[model samples]
Target: MTEERNSLKEFFNYLRHHDLKMETVPLKEQKDYQHPDDDVDFHAYRILLLIFICGILKPTFFDNFTIYGRGKFSFYDFLIRYPFYLEKALRIKNKEDKIKDLEIKHYETEEAFSPMIRYIRGPWDHKYPDILNYMVSKNLITVHYSYFNKSQKAFCITLTDLGLETAQKIQTEEPIWTKRMEAINAIFRKDAQNQTIEMFVREHFSTLILGNAGE
Candidate 1:
């Protein structure tokens, strides 16, 4: 545990050198920096959240949190995984003076996009656009929709140079987000038992996992 903690710290420090440590930056200031067409409600915190997840899982400015691909990459994956990671990363003590485990270990399974599609936002409630759609609209990402084989169409998500620059800006983001990233990495590292709630999510949304191009 000690070694793992040290390495996580070291990795964070590594990003700090590139100005990824925003422990001193205010949230409002971060909010002030965003694309014009991007919705303030979504961009204020949510976009950065997405970027951070993408950064950690792929660990490269070049890789994207893909929507449809040949690998374990998609917004659906985040929806399913974030809750689990959050529960694992956060620990709370109970009245018994003993630690009560918060992780439910199993989430009631749903299709990956179920939550997002059903998510109601703000006073003028509407289904949020596909996050990738918003990203592309804001010029933060470049996407290619093409068929990988005869029957499989796929969309590959990659960062634009501008997107890459913005990602760098987000690297040194607010402190709470920084800790979340650390916790996420820890959770990902500790899943050595091959335990994942993603199986059903993946199966239910096989189109995403299988790169279902619109036929």
Candidate 2:
């Protein structure tokens, strides 16, 4: 009976030491794993949100004061994506000065232009069909395609009345985004009136767009 008691005591001692050590071990931080589809959906929703803001800004219609071509639409999408650049551009009073400042800053450092550089090179046009189709299905926007020939094709997009109303409602609900959109529109509206916003974007980002054309 004494031997058995000692054996039990040793077992308890072993467990006490091992269990306490195990309890003291720190746990590694767990990373949040997002699915690939989640990223796609995130960008899709971002595009939709930007389009909604466009409805409020009215810069979505830059062609003939009623519609905008796909290239022009893509340009606006780029601006909406990187609003930091837009906000900075707004600080400069003159349009030419804004373009020059942006270009200089973009070339100043690789980090400054890396994200914008990557976006300019990305397959943004490939994602357009899916987003535009979904918006059309929701009656938020309409797309018009004109194909005269391989080199003479044109694609236009315009927001629906429902889209504009929904955008206004979103602005009412989200004051932070509303202020950002208003600031963005302040810069875009000027060039949009002259139907030169796309040209402005091209000029503002010539180094990124034109310089990286081969890539």
Candidate 3:
């Protein structure tokens, strides 16, 4: 068990450094870091997805923790809210007031890594496929192509066994994360309607991300 803990520690360190370090390594050896087909960095993907999953799996009552894609199997909800929630969960100040916490990313390499645009630059950024696709391909999640309101809402998503297992790690290993979930769940419990979650998100996150949008 002690050896395994040490290995996990090393892996986390590798994630923080390896990708950027790859760019600086000898030009002749850069190819070693490149995968044959996948362009997405699985290392960084893990970190980003961890945050995404934490948001998806965050606090809710009766354990109803699913993201609906508004009549399609899309990343709409996750893209718009997860980043905002995760940073605050980490107690990271969100200077962008955006769903994408661009303010937290401070490196040149991180700029190209926007799964979604850092802000409402335009409609195009919102239309781009969300990084959630990577999880789908990895069997971490599955998108259901059915509608709840008779095609009014076409898509939704749920975490797979793999996804749940991954979440268990964070929930067990990170105390703050456990508390964040508890906090979000508490917010939901206090609201009688429970349907006005967007309103609640706006109340807590709007001012930080939007100058006056929440107003």
Regions more than 4 Å wrong, model 2:
1-67, 94-125, 145-154, 190-195, 210-215
**In the order shown, what is each candidate's alpha-carbon RMSD?**
19.8, 10.3, 15.2
Reference-based TM-score of each model: 0.39, 0.52, 0.41
Clashes of each: 5, 0, 7
Best by lDDT: 2
lDDT of 1 at 107: 44
Q: Pull out the clashing pairs in model 3.
A: 71-153, 71-154, 71-155, 72-154, 72-155, 73-155, 97-209
Error of 1 at 3 (Å): 72
Cα lDDT tens digits for candidate 3, 1-215: 99999999988799787763434767776665565224544432343333333334424311223445331112222322343444453343322232232333344223323443233211113432444566677766665654334324334455667766775665566554344343333333322221344444355545333234542
Q: 54, model 3: CA deviation in Å?
A: 7.9
**Error in Å for residue 87 of model 3:** 11
Residue pairs in candidate 1 whose N, alpha carbon or C atoms collide under 3 angstroms? 20-171, 20-172, 21-172, 22-172, 153-213
- 81-121 in candidate 2: lDDT tens per residue? 55555655576544443443233344333332213333452
Better of 1 and 3 by lDDT: 1
**TM-score for candidate 3, residues paired by index:** 0.41
lDDT of each: 0.42, 0.51, 0.41
Off by over 4 Å in 1: 1-45, 56-85, 88-130, 145-155, 189-197, 200-215
**Residue 24, candidate 3: C-alpha displacement in angstroms:** 9.1
Give the top-scoring candidate (TM-score).
Answer: 2
Between candidates 1 and 2, which one is better according to lDDT?
2
